[model samples]
Target: MVNDVLAIHNGNYSWNIAFERGLQDLELDDYALLLTSLHEVHIKVGEDDRSKWKSGRDGIYSVCTYLRSILGSTESSFPWKMTLTVDNLHRKGFYVTEWCYMCKRDGETNDHLFLHCEGVRWLWNTILTSQHMDWVMPRRMEDVLRAWSRKFRDKDSGLVWNLFPGCIVWCVWRERNIRCFEDQAKTTEQIREWFYMTLYT
Candidate 1:
């Protein structure tokens, strides 16, 4: 819902913005609230859509649950936007300058930055292997996202691609930002290690 950041449900999320922001920056806890109770806010939304956020007995948790559902991650106790690879360079008043720093030919769109960048392609392979998950890196982020969903639709070989995607997306974006702002350099292994560290936390 709105890139995983829906507006407040009865002002609860608004009140917790600071705490949520802190957890996101630190890569800490992600909360999952059980939403329940509707119809009260209704008289408009039909019964089918109305009761989704209301589950438990009294449904006093409706507002928080509604907000969490909008976040699209019941497993995740924390709310996070999908990893954004696009640089803010567009805001600096230049269009042609969006080309990849490592691959001058391609624009630094989400697909290029996260998928086809020469350096990143190598890193992605390493990341998959280290995670002990069999994954094929697509030529573009869109392709990768599509394949990822299809691959993880069911469990196989004692692996769960579902659990790892969130961490993978998180780590890739972190590395991109590191190079962009910190002037740091890292190898494929280093990036994988970072992902592990973040995941365990």
Candidate 2:
């Protein structure tokens, strides 16, 4: 799974410390909201899978495929940006509408990629007890993010596990941009590798 590969989003030094420090500012309701919406079960893995940790992590990568997005109602996936959909709205307005690059659903936007990408289905499975997450994919990214946050909210709870999801999402979007404008592309492996590089070091 991606978490096993590029496991941390490290662009911002002290990011973990900062995030933890800010936790105190949250009210009990914020914590409750966070937990209620957290989809922690989406990452459950079989006990047998413990052995394939590294392999699972590496499989989350796309080593040879070019990062490309199919044409849609929007002009291009260049200006595309995905942010926390805390209240059921993307950071920007949906111009024409889009579908997830990996899922090929009716609507391919930030939420789809975050919560429903089959590309990351294996990764999500690591959190769910069922050993498969895509089967019962959440309706939106906000739910996934909050669920992830709540599940790993504890300091001793491996909350850093969130880095994998956040980094993959960011890297995928970055690759889409590079492909659209620079006419450049990277294999999924390269993207996964770069995700680790850009996010951590």
Candidate 3:
């Protein structure tokens, strides 16, 4: 699968394909991590394929090493050092349009695009109404997540409820990209349907 997306270019592995859809914030971070991890990998011609456990000193697999590799050596951070939001792009000296693509009424920021835009608010309200839950949206995305986490603790609905915010944000972001880059927009109903489809599957 990796070979399908990568190619040996000038004796070094390079990405040879483009993603079908724009990557989300977290997905972009993961992609960065992947590239970082692969930076040192060298391909040797005429060599047999063999598995080596890099986590162990002897390149041998062990239970402790395996567990440590999976658990990691330190607490993971959000890795939000940078984002692709218009505000961030402006900070990076890219002079793109400042207005929000979805609503076009406010400057585009991470919070406004994902949570606070007029259209985004309507989508959030629709989700809450479907669950018969009333919520006062917070000023920040972190606060909204904190509030949602506190409300749902049950085993069944809680899991789906916990996933709802992420699902909504992802769907909204994809729609935003479609409108910005492709000059195409999906109706609120279409966005809602896309969110539900993404959440369940």
Candidate 4:
């Protein structure tokens, strides 16, 4: 009966008839009229499914909402960390040299620290391989988020996939700080283990 209500893959059944039958099968006669009210809903065929963010008028997640979600009294978000990188710090009077604290092979930028550096690339590739995903790393943050959201369709996989970019951003930035301030560096295995432990529990 519950499966009847969730028969979204029933291509053989006409949409309205299937929905009405599903309601009757579930003994939801009380909701028959209410459910029928959704008949006017427009579903564009041959289009990718898009889930909207209820909080945003545009049906897309806004930066304000993202910031609110990840921010706490003591913690900032991944984007905030990227904004305050060593390169940006130099501009703001922190007087730090502009080199990726992670790899130190190239100048630091948010993209380099989060996505492009060889060490970061190795870390991301290892994680993706573990999940049996073969995604190409995007050069920009927005592209990465778009790819993750589009590719992972199942709830559990999508949730984990959605968190990976932000987690990697935060972890990589933290590792950069440890190298610069705490005089410590971590191997790729250590970083991978830390990410998995943080993600699962």
Against the true structure, whose TM-score is highest? 3
Clashes of 2: 21
lDDT of 4 at 28: 74
The positional error of residue 17 in candidate 3, measured at the CA in angstroms, is 28
Q: Per-residue lDDT for 46 in model 3? A: 42
- Lowest summed lDDT over 10 consecutive residues: which window, candidate 2? 10-19
Whichever of 2 and 4 has more lDDT, that candidate is: 4
Question: In candidate 3, what are the lDDT values of residues 6-88, reduced to their tens digit?
Answer: 67666656766578998898798888887777766766744666888999999999986776775566332221224477987
In lDDT terms, how accurate is model 1?
0.54
TM values, all candidates: 0.45, 0.39, 0.60, 0.57
What CA RMSD would candidate 1 show?
A: 13.9
Ranking by lDDT: 3, 4, 1, 2
Candidates sorted by TM-score, best first: 3, 4, 1, 2
Question: Candidate 2, which segments miss by more than 4 Å at Cα?
Answer: 1-107, 119-136, 150-159
Better of 2 and 3 by lDDT: 3
Candidate 1 lDDT, 1-201, residue by residue in tens = 321432346433322223434345335433322122221233332223333325435655565565565655554343333333334445444444556654446767666766777866666676577667676566655456556654444476225455455676567667766776797867767876777687666
TM-score, cand. 3: 0.60
Regarding lDDT, does 1 or 3 come out ahead? 3
* Predicted candidate 4 versus true structure: per-residue lDDT over 1-201, tens digit per residue: 423343354343224335424444567765666567555555554457678876667779988766655553323234544378767677677876768888888888777888899878887887789788798777776667656654556888778877777778768878888898999998888988887787777
Overall lDDT per candidate, in order of appearance = 0.54, 0.48, 0.78, 0.70
